[model samples]
Target: MHDAISYLLFLVGTFLAAGVVKGVTGMGLPTVAMGLLGTVMPPASAAAILVIPSFVTNVWQLFYGPSVAQLIRRFWPMMLGIILGTVGGAALLVRVDPVWSGCWLGVALMAYAGYALIAPAFSVPAALERRLSPLVGLITGVVTGATGVFVMPAVPYLGSLNMSREELVQALGLSFTTSTIALAAGLFAHGAFQVSQLGTSAMAIVPALIGMWAGQYVRMRISPKRFRQCFLFFLIALGLELASRPLL
Candidate 1:
């Protein structure tokens, strides 16, 4: 963050771009925001600024297409694992170098982009869900805690669950919402999250929402697959940029 005005402009632009990605693809807000912001700021500061908007948006998405109770009943272990893993791994941010954090963050972004672009065909047996979900959640949470991006193995794991599209979407909402809460808690535990970040983080909501609205409109009229491919490719580029920072 440089001058106040420039910071706000950049914040708004970054989040607006993130919102559009999420609107079109049903995910990617944190991934895109963290990737871009991590380039210029430490992971902890970026994570702090990200907490509110990510929570607000994902919470909204969480309630829309399913029974929350059923989701919790089925996914509680995994959710619990996320909380535990995030709590356990949060110290990485306080202890590790920011350059290492950014490099890992970029790798996480690239991992997700490659997976989503390829859209691998795989499925978990229903019987195995009970055994595997928590493991996936824990890995996701550790990544979330370490890098401030939480999609990786979790999103791909979710897709592998063979859930119906509606359930899948809402489940992702729940997963993201849970990750956001845990990330906030992790930041709070270190006192890295502060009230000073709140105003700008909250102000970011308007642009994010506006961009989402616009993206929804674009989603209807265009080839979403094509748009998504472009977005994924862009993420790969961003990933490369961030990953190169330590070297640069």
Candidate 2:
């Protein structure tokens, strides 16, 4: 009984912290949640619990933008590609040994951290966006499926689209929402995610929201850029530890 309570506490704390990171950094909820939870549970279970909180938080981010219709019309191919890639890889995610999946997830975290830290400057020509977006989505989908971390080629690709700051945030929301929904669908289809688990997932939102609120408040007082740098560095350390867990 105590063990169950401890587990629940730890789970709540993980989401809460992840939420705070998102509020401050404008991202990292899934990556942080998955990284921490992967320490205590298999990647599949971590991902299953991640579905609801991720979807709910990203929804508000998705709808508040002025160019939803325009973004959707432009990125539909990428969205479809994410769904297809997730469906294709769901079986692998569930069937593989947890050790390898954890390693992949860790690698993904490191890659994302590296890319985000560098914040490299480049852009896809408008002429190439139509062709490159789907490819980027497909690769992002594979990464998302294998590790359940949704940032990658997708975020960088989106960054390269030459959007304004506000559009970029909303665009990120759209991308994350699509990934979350695809992930849930893939899990449901594979029977890795069950109805019974959803209650706890729903409950998790309370802490996540609270943490996000706290983070937003903190954001008003702190340097978000510095916070994000620290956060990314933390992800690198966490990723290294996770990747090395099996070897150790």
Candidate 3:
């Protein structure tokens, strides 16, 4: 009984911390949550618990920006690719070993963190946006489906578009929303999402929202640049830890 209570408390605290990161940076809920929870549970289970909260939070972000219609119109192809790729990739999730999945996730996290730290200045050419968007979406979807972490080629692809900060945030929201829904569908298809898990996922929303609120308050006070550096460093460490688990 005590162990159960402790686990529940850990989950609440995890979501709260993840929420604060998302509230401040407009992302990181799943990455942070999965990183921490994967230590306690299977990777697939961690991903399962993230479904509802990730969707709700990204939905909030999706509507908070201007020109939703325009954004949708521009990114529909990528969205479609995301759905297809996720469905395909998620089919593998149920069959893969948990340790392997954790290693894959860890590698992905490290790669993502490394890329972010390098901070390349390249942008997608206007001419190539039409050609490259679907590919990016497909890749991102596959990664998300396989690892339950969605922020690879997609985030970089979106950043390459050179949208204004507000537009970029909204675009991320849209991408994340699409990823969350597709992830949920994949999990359902694999029979990984049980009713009991759904209840836990739903309850997590409260703490996530609370953390978001607190994070928003902190965002007003801190330097985003500095915060991001710290966040990425943490991810790098977490990624290393996750990657080493298979060997351990």
Given candidate 2, what's the lDDT at residue 47?
A: 92
> Which segments of candidate 3 are over 4 A away from where they belong?
none
Ranking of predictions according to lDDT: 3, 2, 1
Cα displacement (Å) at residue 2, model 1:
8.5
User: Which whole-number lDDT from 0 to 100 does residue 186 have in model 2?
Assistant: 86
lDDT (tens digit, per residue) of candidate 3 on 92-124: 666788888888888888988899999889888
Q: Is candidate 1 or candidate 3 better by lDDT?
A: 3
Q: Compared with the true structure, what per-residue lDDT tens digits does model 2 show for residues 1-248? A: 99999999999999999999989978889999999999989898999999999999998788877989988898999998888887767767788899999998999999999989998899889999889888888888878888889998898899898899888888899999999999988888888999998998999899999989999999999999899999999999999998998798
Q: Write the per-residue lDDT of candidate 1 for residues 1-248, one digit (tens) a residue.
A: 36977877889999999999888988999988898889789988999889888988898888987578898899999999898888767789757899988898888889889988888799899999999989989998898898899897889888888788888888999999999999989988977788898887788788888877878888999999999999999999989988888898
Candidate 2's displacement at residue 136, Å, is 0.7
After TM-score superposition, what is the CA distance of residue 13 in candidate 1 from its true location, in Å?
Answer: 0.5
TM-score of each: 0.97, 0.98, 0.98
Q: Write the number of the candidate with greater TM-score, choosing between 1 and 2.
A: 2
What's the C-alpha lDDT at position 139 in model 2? 85
Q: Whole-model lDDT, candidate 3?
A: 0.90
User: Mind sharing the TM-score for model 1?
Assistant: 0.97
